[model samples]
Target: MKNDPNFIAAYGNIPTFESLEEREKWLDTLDKIYTEVNDNFEKEMSKYFYPNGPVIAYGYTIDGVLKVAIEKGQKIDAAKENELYDLFSNYGQNIAVKDVPLIIVYEDLPTPTSRTSSWRPIIGGIKICTEKPDGIKQSTLGFSAQTSSGTKGYVVAGHTAPSIGDQIWQPTAGPSANKVGTVSKVGGHYADASWVPYSNVAAKIYDTDTDVLKDVKSHENAAIGDTVYKSGITTGRSYGSVTEIRTSYDNPLGTLYRQYVAGYNCDGGDSGAPVYVYVSGGVKIVGIHWGGVGTYNSGYSTSIFSPVSGVQSDLGVTPLTA
Candidate 1:
């Protein structure tokens, strides 16, 4: 894929550098370019789907083109989903149809609602809860951070709270599990995360590989194709690549911006899982895993993450470090 003419023209044309700083600087430029491409594609192509039809999602791909996810059984242009897939797969890239440039692809995917919160209350463990009538649901617990008042608090999905001050527990129903924290604040429209202050859990992540603890040092903005990891109760430890950065996804929860997509195989309970990449010495936090779509095992599925830097700024907290 790297050597493809279209891919190189759109994504691989960035300058190469030997120094990490220079490499990062170049990646930043590429990131901005991709973000603009994404924004332009959304503005122009979004009207082609949704409210008007069955298209559920429209976003940019790593190849710098548009991707549309339609609901199962949904049809477009009087063509069946499979037929449209073939047509796009075989000829979409060859067609230069817009000034913004687009190679539209289709996938059958849909969003699922959150259920009740229940699980083991490890720092990076699963935090499951219900959204009223949505039934049982789950999300990952991001590590704790120092609030503006110097208080410490862990983070979870805002949708899990449903209401502020809701008691968040380890196991949503079991007798042995205990209440770790309560929903202190929900970022509702700003982010898919919430602060849980006064939690008994420590500001440490359970390493699934070493079976040890790794303290989070700082937060970071993810770049496309970066290798990141996440730990959740459902999927345990998962390693995936940042597929898209600075993208927008609209769903029932709300439209989240400056978001990124990863190929990590995550489940429902994995929401809020801390996404990080190993740096020179310690780990740099990347994002908080949210919801995902498409078949989990399918190559096309992706898990959404809210940039950790954005989360911290919006919530007014700094990641707790060793």
Candidate 2:
């Protein structure tokens, strides 16, 4: 439509928001378009974009414009672009193509087994698992919930859990001693967080600095420029800001979407660490730390996170509070 703000924004022009409510109103429209486009991509669009195809991958709205990252040597066909444009309408026209194929997804190389001597308190970022010899550790103990069995369970990264019924323990326990919990459910592949059927873990997160104890209460989504914090087994507690969201990339199993990116230092053992935003007196769960790319201060490093809401929906649990 003529004079549409989305249209204006499409041509590299800034769309003005008269008030906070107006900005949110525009964001609602943009988010809806994003959701509809992504839902269609997962359901019907992915098949059309295969290896070396026109539409290699889709991305969420960045600066109110939807984007599609194309293969190195090709561009999206006009017809397909138009179809998206028609769907997104004003903002959809902003859907543009880039040389790179969205975000690149990579798996972390397994680290060599190294043992820590003493048993540490069970908290976010501490290693805990059922695997023998060397047990896997908890991500950020993302949240806790009262299960249908009336007992409480905590959250961790799914890929870290070796099996559904595996008994969880601290790494120092070496398969026997410090039993902490068990993996009640595992959601692998695109869904990364798993559920552990135990309440022994505390809601507080451990920081490498040993100063701040991140207490997570509610869950929220990351926005551009929002300062975020994460506690991981490898990197300990790190601070960064959200740079991108509504992002996606191709993984081994399939295409993954609705992921966020931050400028933080993260490593292999850090997977499943709780990523949250600090609020008054506590923090709000935002995303679960996963594998990231590049190096810190190198101008290319970025920490990737799976939205906490997605994990909650998949695992049917919430972050533990007080």
Candidate 3:
């Protein structure tokens, strides 16, 4: 027997290579052929994925399993979301769970749009407007507090001020009586920040996903080319890098100095949104968004944010650490 009687009976057609290079060539061919076959299989399988939308990604696993990923905060219908599992036996594969496996993982991710609707929570990333729409001073609130003095409050655009003790309502289009808080303090030339004290406050912010809050740790200074992120009622949430730090911008209230300019843009109501960088556990507040030269145009434009450290000093408020 060349090797064994049983082996020769079923595998005698196995190829014999005269040289190592010949065998290597055949092995390379096998790898390409197998990969192409798998690619086609995946392409056809994608048709059955979540067609209704909101899917992050989906594909076939290495071991012939099907895997799908969705947003963490999305609501899933058991039967609808699990339709793939019901057909496990249809493709001549094993019907048991272990034989034809399916894996679904959830992640906390931002939605496509920013939140402009009225949020009862006094956290950041929601719309806030004057009680009477006095010229429609819509703006965004930054994170709340956990300071050394044990004082609690929220921050917004100083230009969005309707004067101290005046009412700030969520969703300027909603009910007139839906008051959230009042403007407590408006800073000087150092920072365009307004403090609005409220009980329902947290050191968190967001874009559309109001239920899932991202914690704000402390404060940091933005550097050129450093990554930045923000979510505002008008412009939504977008990612960009700090193109310039210690930049200056002139405003009607005063001249803001050492402001951070981001590559991303903002809109009219996006003022006072949090512009921060993602840190290890959560994020650090870099500044409070005001506006950029682009705000003078008719579309989304570059943004300016007053550095957080100076804003805290000017406003005389302690920032949240926890």
Candidate 4:
């Protein structure tokens, strides 16, 4: 049976059977047992006599028992099922079913979100100012900065509120301009704000060719249940579902202001990270990492971030040129 080309074509090549007589004897025994079964008698007899009747031999083994499923929709009777089970239980223990093959119907299943890899940026970093006079301390998680004209900025969370002309670092790699800039504006909660490049730093620091900030005049926005992603120098990257949106409140430090975007866990160094929307082509920066209420494992609680629209409306800054 293993040497047959038709069988080999369907189930791939296998070693030839040791004895044709032994193989024939085993198949004959299965046929006889199936023919005697009352429920499957007619079907079995027809197959036994017909040129193209369904064959009833061992198909394959899953754990220990020989698997007896239909090659096609060819139905089996209760009696045949019982007889086959009995035969397998009584004398099929030592039989090798590994070389046996069976044809099965295929079905499709849903793809899980956990296995999905899709996200992109919508907004880019800009500078802003704080309305209050008191400075906010830098945080381990970081804050989002916004300009009065609505331009966006990446504020170092928990860090002291930076003043005008203060040199700021653009963690992104590039030329000297891409590496650093000076504080320009300030406002809002936590005194989180934006800074402008004192030199051609914006062009030098950001990858004008790929950085979304180089093109998008306004930051991206997101709604509840929207998909989002974030990336930073600290935390590599991550994706999650947005559980909430625009929310306001206060914290022990001071009055907190931000839009809540829920998702998976992020860490302290991830502060000031850029949040993006996942698209087919690339990532679109939508917001900046401000702070969140929950721990990483418990899942994202209310993650606070600055909106791109607010950044644009507050700051007249446009996306950098290529």
Question: Which lDDT values do the candidates have, in the order given?
Answer: 0.58, 0.56, 0.58, 0.37
Worst 10 residues of 1 by lDDT: 5-14
Tell me the tens digit of each residue's lDDT in model 2 across 97-140: 22111122222221211112233444555555435445444433
The better candidate by TM-score, 1 or 2, is: 2
Clashes of each: 16, 5, 0, 46
List TM-scores for all candidates, in order. 0.70, 0.70, 0.58, 0.41
What's the C-alpha lDDT at position 286 in model 4? 66
- Put down candidate 4 lDDT per residue, 1-322, tens digits, no spaces: 3363223112212234477665445444433332233234344423421123333222222111123323233544556545545543333233443333222211111010100111111123222222224442112212233334555444333222335665443322234543344556543442233434333222111111233332323246765456766654333456676643322332222322334445645544444555666443344556556554432443343355555554444433333322
Query: TM-score for model 1?
Result: 0.70
Which candidate's TM-score is highest?
2
At residue 71, what lDDT does model 3 achieve? 45
Residue 199, model 3: Cα distance from true site in angstroms: 1.8
Error of 4 at 287 (Å): 1.0
Error at 54, model 4, angstroms: 76
